[model samples]
Target chain A: MVVRRPGGRSARVRAAVHQAVTELVAERGYGKFTVADVAARAGVADTSVYRRWGDLEELTADVVITWLTRTSPVPDTGTLDGDLRTYAANVVREADGPAGPAVLRLVIALAAAGETGARAREQFLAERSRQLRTMLDRARARGEEAPEVADVVDQILAPVYVRSLFGMGPLTGELADDLVDRMLGTPGRGPS
Target chain B: MVVRRPGGRSARVRAAVHQAVTELVAERGYGKFTVADVAARAGVADTSVYRRWGDLEELTADVVITWLTRTSPVPDTGTLDGDLRTYAANVVREADGPAGPAVLRLVIALAAAGETGARAREQFLAERSRQLRTMLDRARARGEEAPEVADVVDQILAPVYVRSLFGMGPLTGELADDLVDRMLGTPGRGPS
Candidate 1:
């Protein structure tokens, strides 16, 4: 079967390349890997990857940076708790495919890999920090009781990321709801 | 200047090997590197490393597992809050040395690198989790209001590890103190 795209081929090429990298990293991780492998996996000419990215590290950086920047928008599900729960669940589900936690592990490993990785890590942190700050601001604008932003960020969100890295239990909406209620100084309805 | 130690030469050799590996990772990031390089840096025979650990990844695991297991003892500062603060400060200071965060980055990278790494990573996490459970149990025995253990662990300790991994900011006694207080439901001394 043959498929055709409506838009420019480059966009589809970029998408295929990155998606292939994600799958490879999730399966075998980043060690002793090659860009040629990614190119072949994408069904693109190895020359396209070689001409553009040059190496595995640079190619990995491009894929991670794209994933970080292109995640879903900050939610506005009416209530602060509702938005938080929805977003947290969405974040978890997005990475909870057949790949399991390999995608998240690969992202963290890439960020800690080297100079190229350090750059991606910092950019991802900065981008996510902005998203959190914006979501908090939006919640406050909606007349939600403003909570301690740093506490919510460092204490609540950090755990989610850390535990995710360890593949510790499932990332649940109940867990997100507990975090939201705790941050807002409200009692949860106990696990239903 | 030659100094002699009372311990056997094997102990001295192991110490030098680990110390050399740490220094190398700190300076070079854990990119493509070799065990022969580590042995050369440590002034040990490459065969000694090859005989004990088959590859750079396994050797890397040894260095990190030793570091994680031998970190500061859990503090017993009378009160749970005081103990938590002291231990947290101790953890932060331990990683704030010449090797800096690079050693940590390397450890995490090695853990995610392959099968040997995955085993080492699990060992490290399990060891730390046991230590935390023990500490929380001691606090409860001492009449502290027992909060949810997983929540307490996730909220108070996870941030410390997350922030350390990211090099996000300085880990301070003040920060640890606040985490302990927050877990205990005590109002922070300032900026709520």
Candidate 2:
């Protein structure tokens, strides 16, 4: 891992604190956690946690943002249907992989807690939206889709988040492709 | 307006309790509010708070579930595109209405907090997904869309939730309709 050294000790301290926050939240839930617990778990000074972050919410946002940055970009397949299917497949792959469910559960958990948690959820969603838009724009530019695909993209891809967050149903590769093709209205293969 | 019973004390009490939970969550946030505070705000006996719900998380879930059930259903326009546009428009209307931002903010707040909150968030999404599926299925049954439209619907509509929860952009009537047409790939004066 490339260590961030610009802020030196502060950066190191922040990393430790963030790791602790994620772990503690996972283990105890946000309502049950405290800054003191985070500080202890991180093996850092309590003053450090207080000095670095105004509160746990800000700290949580930073940690999530950093984690999100590490996620891979959506693949380019030169076709809207192919691209969306690929994207949905990636979502499923991530969900089946290690950091996926944890982060998702964390977000859902936070959202359930109420306002502060809600803000964190919104921040995370905003970041995802920006990324999705970029991917969609690229596809549109590549002539993989009509210029008007953005609206459909939102509707087509919503099930993944719904599945991930709500545990409602399976979001598999086949389902993803089916969804994409249906929304695209791919001739005989559309909808039904 | 209409009272449930003669005394209607129980209904009044529930309403008061729900209102208190919403306000406390909005104010101090879920993290800071306790059962005692919720009871005090509702002007109910503390024992009642404990008796009615096993714990604070459960109480929060009840209040949220109640609120979600009250959200109006999307209309039937006898066409998939029209239905979706109406659905999206309805969602946008609610999201922008009086209770929209606050309730949304609250759900995100709790879900972000941790496991119990995550469970609550899942329930919230479940209700929404169920309602959405019902509407979509009816449209498909009417041959407005193919049988495969379920997945298509999932894909096209997921972005709105993604944007809403994440605070990405405005999901207005015109924008929603545009999205509906794009995902459905229908030609018209929809999104370019």
Of candidate 2 chain B, the 10-residue stretch with the lowest lDDT total is B183-192
Tens-digit lDDT track for model 2 on A58-99?
778777777765664566787766666777677666664557
Indicate the residue-level lDDT of A117 in model 2.
Answer: 80
* lDDT, candidate 1, A1-192, per-residue tens: 868667668888889999888878766666546777888889999889888877666677677656654564567788877777676666655544444345556655754566756666665666677777777788789887555456655655666766665555567766666565565553221111
Best by TM-score: 1
What are the candidates' C-alpha RMSDs?
Answer: 6.1, 7.1
Write down the worst ten-residue block by lDDT for model 2 chain A.
Answer: A183-192
Local accuracy of candidate 2 as per-residue lDDT tens digits, B76-116:
78786766767667666666566665675566566556686
Score candidate 2 by TM-score against the native.
Answer: 0.62
TM-score of 1: 0.71
Per-model i-RMS: 8.9, 8.4
The local distance difference test score of each candidate is 0.66, 0.66
lDDT computed for candidate 1:
0.66
